[model samples]
Target: MKNTKAMRHSGPSAELEAKGLHRLAGERVLLDNISLSVHGGDRIAIVGPTGSGKSLLLRSLAMLDPIDAGEVQWRGESVHGRDIPRFRSQVIYLQQRPALVEGTVEENLRQPYFLRAHRDKHFDRERVSRLLSSLGRGDSFLSQHQRDLSGGESQLTALLRAVQLDPAILLLDEPTAALDSDSTAMVERLVIDWLSEMPSDRATVWVTHDDEQSRRISNAMLQIHDGKLSKDVHERIR
Candidate 1:
């Protein structure tokens, strides 16, 4: 069944919106006039050929990269000044390649809470262990060095860190790109379980080149091509 709230023709407004977002590289336009809305419970998949600005657009939405023009608004208010840090805390962006710390995975997971933005939150070992267990890992996995982890393990660890943060919006930029088929499926299951945990409050914007993967994970689809977003894209899965 389709999520009627997401497909509503009227009523509630978007949770996040990028108004007239424009980016240029000297003479070339990277993201041109990109504007879209992300509503509550929206699982949006961004699809396009390589080098088509999908990741650039995701960063733009995350407010990590400075947009040359336009603004990103969360719940109708613009993200600026002091709001940046708090906004980022609520809107977490995970790249394809996650950077782990020099220490063990457990230490790397503990580091985020020490950051200024996350100081109020304490690391929960029991909760994280449960999360890891759901992804076919054990408590011992946490003690393993980052160097010992495979591509899939690293990705899982990164995702566990993100999920523990409990961000309202998750921006995933080809997170499973480097993993094998089994690992990719495992990642998808992790995401599904995470999303199901807070179906009404959280949403994810996943960037993937696989059409089947996109269809499996997303309720809506957006195509980015030549710095522009095509509006007439949908996958009817009713």
Candidate 2:
């Protein structure tokens, strides 16, 4: 019996919020008036079986996929058209599958800095190396070809790319699904360490099919079933 609603919340302002979000697929509802608030220091785990709309919920929150209805707000401000790019920078989204382009990982990492929205930020190799070293990899990892990397390496590269941006909210959709036990544990540790660095101003929403992983990753739990959301999960954390 895990307690989903037993979260300890940070007072006042929230970092991100979804209000009455809804989505449709043909005639069926994929997301039904879903809403949740992610405040600074909040770590929430979203759990559900396959085809239960868990990914849809995370994508909606990330604004990668447009919701048919509802609004996504950051720091209480509604995110609109022109602000999408900037919003994305602040709230990064990482999919389960690695979507790296063909090239050295360093190239993939430098891609974001070239984007118009991120032009103000510069790519720092030393910082990148530091992050890689933290994951037990040396600076040589950056020189590895994206196509030549292993499953775990690719996932690690993807995470490194996102962490460099220092997003305030991270929307993780089964990032470790394709990874083995050791790799999965590495990913978890990397992310948790990153969050611990800014515990007061950063939060993450992790979606995992593994109950044990969810319990370890989140301070609170949310279950989505048949397109609906359960704020307080009553199942015991094993």
lDDT of candidates 1 onward, in order: 0.85, 0.87
Task: Give TM-scores for every candidate, taking all chains together and pairing residue i with residue i.
Answer: 0.93, 0.94
Candidate 1: regions farther than 4 A off: 1-11, 235-238
lDDT of 2 by residue, 1-238 (tens): 1222354558586678788889999999999888788888888889998999999999999998988999999988999999999999999999999899889999999999988978999899998887778778898889889989999999988998898898998999999998999999889988998998999789899999998899898877888998888656623342
lDDT of 2 at 136: 85
Query: In candidate 1, what are the lDDT values of residues 102-170, reduced to their tens digit?
Result: 889999899889888899999999998888788778899999999999999888888888888889889
lDDT of candidate 2 at residue 58, scale 0 to 100: 96
Q: Clash number for model 1? A: 0
Regions of candidate 2 where Cα sits further than 4 Å from its true position:
1-8, 234-238
Per-candidate clashes come to: 0, 6
